[model samples]
Target: MASPARSLNPTPPLKGSFPLDHFGECKAFRIDYLKCLKERDGAQYECRDVAQRYLQCRMDAGLMEKEEMSKLGYTKSNSNRRRVSQDSYKKSKESKGFIAGLSK
Candidate 1:
């Protein structure tokens, strides 16, 4: 009798298959994303930030593989940018238009 063949690579599916988070490791993030979607009337694009958070939580919890957010189609969050002070806003308004100085 022939022996059963084994998979040469035992890695799990990269997409559409993930272990259930029975320990609720990412439950809060999932709930938050769901709430955002509900609030947006299911307009998923409006909930991209929350969705990203949920995905990040899953990755951190080992429920999914870690991946670059850029490769996953997410833009760099605004939190990474330097904050502009009220003084800067005023100065920009005084000089160029606020929108024009936004790129500075």
Candidate 2:
């Protein structure tokens, strides 16, 4: 019987954790993505935008590296250019409320 061959180049273990909630900046985006997933019955494609925004927030906060973000399907140009405003925050909450109503 032939012996099993070992791979020459093994994938390296991930260096660090992608702490999604370590910073409060991306909390809203994360929640939105999670809610979207639940609403869509775990359909990841439905929440791609929210997920991207959350990842962008992590990248902006230095919680995650650009290379790591790129590996996760985010592009360099996706970096957040402007800060979140109070008006937008209120709008997000209102949208969340609307989504919650749909779940009932």
Candidate 3:
């Protein structure tokens, strides 16, 4: 007797796709992390700050679920602290007339 034929359909992609950053809510931070990874020759540890910011932005914007974020090492308190530090850094740079690669 002949064996039953196997199904030939390909598996469907995930509902929304992986690497939620495609939603664009946190594209800038995602790009920064990508650039950092390239600069560091793919040393993920060297890009932790940028990675964290990208993850935090996705979480804040609801593009990614909190559980998923936590699974990837995100913490609410850590994000809050990083936000404050980033804000201060931007303020200091602005005071020095620096605006995203332009300085007077």
Candidate 4:
């Protein structure tokens, strides 16, 4: 028997603009961001978010200060994680308190 055909829809690559500062210390992070640009099957992942996360990691590691990050436009996430935490959040508000609780 023949195998099922796969969908032909291809994913597009994600691109990020240049660093907020060109000749500043944070420019190094820009290089690191591009180096780790998520690429697979000729498509790139959203670079900014990933880059910011990596930037945050650097900050936590004491390699970069929060001020430097802010100068480079890498502040805290403006998004609400809880809203996108699961597929059910989009389904209904009932999922608000709906959780699998612990047992005795």
Candidate 5:
């Protein structure tokens, strides 16, 4: 018996496509973010800075599309806001009880 011919069709990614960094252009930033994740015990929220850096590196290397940092949820004011929010969360947990803290 003869086998049927095979064909392949590829489509662009739903959100669009990005070039792969086969040259390891952003490998350092990727490593840093991964290390931060490990150090944070997989708490991604704590590694936002590192993750943002990694994205920035990818953009700079033309591995991904360039966009505003604010659009990506990072801005000069954001860092300050994050710090304040963390402080507030800590206070809420101490004074308002766990359930009340979550509301904050």
Candidate 6:
């Protein structure tokens, strides 16, 4: 069997974008992208994975601008704080597949 550890190469783009009905919503992952993902998937998902899939699903969507994920924190260069994996961070940024978002 292949390793689930093996990263998922991105396939074709999903056919959706962030909704406008949330005219008052925030643009960051927690609000905008989370709504997008929940609408895409019937069930709710965590922000990290949803954000990753969003960047994957939409080919032209802007990448997360923050240098560090709010969840994962910083790296060894961040000597003052505990370190985390940059590679893992990048991998998280990558999308696996469009597991949902099929209903629209």
TM agreement with the true structure for every prediction: 0.58, 0.50, 0.49, 0.29, 0.62, 0.19
Q: Residues 2-58, candidate 5, lDDT per residue (tens digit)?
A: 999998898779657877789999999889889998987786767888889889999
Find the candidate with the highest lDDT and give its number: 5
Clashes found in each candidate (C-alpha, N, C closer than 3 A): 0, 0, 0, 0, 0, 1
Ranking by lDDT: 5, 1, 3, 2, 4, 6
Of 3 and 5, the candidate ahead on lDDT is: 5
Evaluate all candidate structures by whole-model CA lDDT and list the values in order: 0.77, 0.69, 0.74, 0.52, 0.83, 0.44
List where candidate 3 sits over 4 angstroms from the true fold: 1-23, 67-71, 74-104
* Pairwise lDDT winner, candidates 1 and 3: 1
Clashing pairs in 6: 40-101
For candidate 1, the clash count comes to: 0
Cα-lDDT of candidate 2: 0.69
lDDT of 4 by residue, 1-104 (tens): 99999989965544332234433545566566666664522122335566776677655555545546556664455333332453355456464544557422
- Any residue pairs clashing in model 5, and if so which? none
Report the poorest 10 consecutive residues by lDDT, candidate 2: 78-87
True-structure lDDT of candidate 4: 0.52
Off-target runs (Cα >4 Å) in candidate 5 are 1-15, 83-104
Task: Locate the minimum summed-lDDT window of 10 residues in model 6.
Answer: 74-83
Comparing candidate 1 with candidate 5, which one achieves the higher lDDT? Answer: 5
Candidate 2 C-alpha lDDT tens digits along 27-88 = 78778999999998885654667888877877788777765656776553443321235346
Query: Model 4: runs farther than 4 Å from truth?
Result: 1-45, 68-70, 74-104
